[model samples]
Target: MPAVLGIEVKLDPKWSIVSTPLFEAYWFTDGLNSGRRDELYSVDVGLRYSFASNLSLTNTVLYEGRTSNVAIRHYRDLRIGPRLDFAF
Candidate 1:
């Protein structure tokens, strides 16, 4: 099963904050890892500024991690960047 939670809050007319969190589970049914389960978690949070109705910029922070019964599958990562979005 996979699940997600998201929220957005407007801070005045041109600025906003947004976040999305997610979780997923994976089951291995065959091979050497049979009957093993892995869990994944991730989230993205951003501050967005709108220049116009069709254009916006967002600075975001992202984190992703995974855990499994197998030690080799455990890992985590963090990322930060700016994203530009436009619609026509």
Candidate 2:
């Protein structure tokens, strides 16, 4: 069980920051809370970069379960490489 919270702040006309609580709950689709498979709904933060009207990129960071944190199975901390998109 988890409680969620959030806030919005406007720094300028072209910039702003929004925050919200994130959590993950794993259960089974076989039945009511079967507790079989696990899923992640990690907490994350992202930055928006606006290089032009037609081009922009969003950078995000997140906290994920570590490999050492797993007691019953193997795991690793969530990580992202990089993302880039071009518009023409």
Candidate that scores best on lDDT: 1
Could you give candidate 2's per-residue lDDT for residues 1-88 as a string of tens digits? 4445654465664444544555554546576435565544455565545566556565656565522233564454655443443688
TM-score of 2: 0.45
Indicate the residue-level lDDT of 80 in model 2.
47
- Scored by CA lDDT, what does every candidate get? 0.96, 0.52
Deviation in Å, model 2, residue 29 alpha carbon: 6.4
- Estimate, for each residue in 1-88, the C-alpha lDDT of model 1 and write its tens digit: 8999988899999999989899999999999889889999999999999999999999999999999998989999999999999999
Q: What is the lDDT of residue 41 in candidate 1?
A: 99
Q: Clashing pairs in model 2?
A: 67-75
Off by over 4 Å in 1: 31-33, 86-88
Task: Return the lDDT, model 1, position 12.
Answer: 92
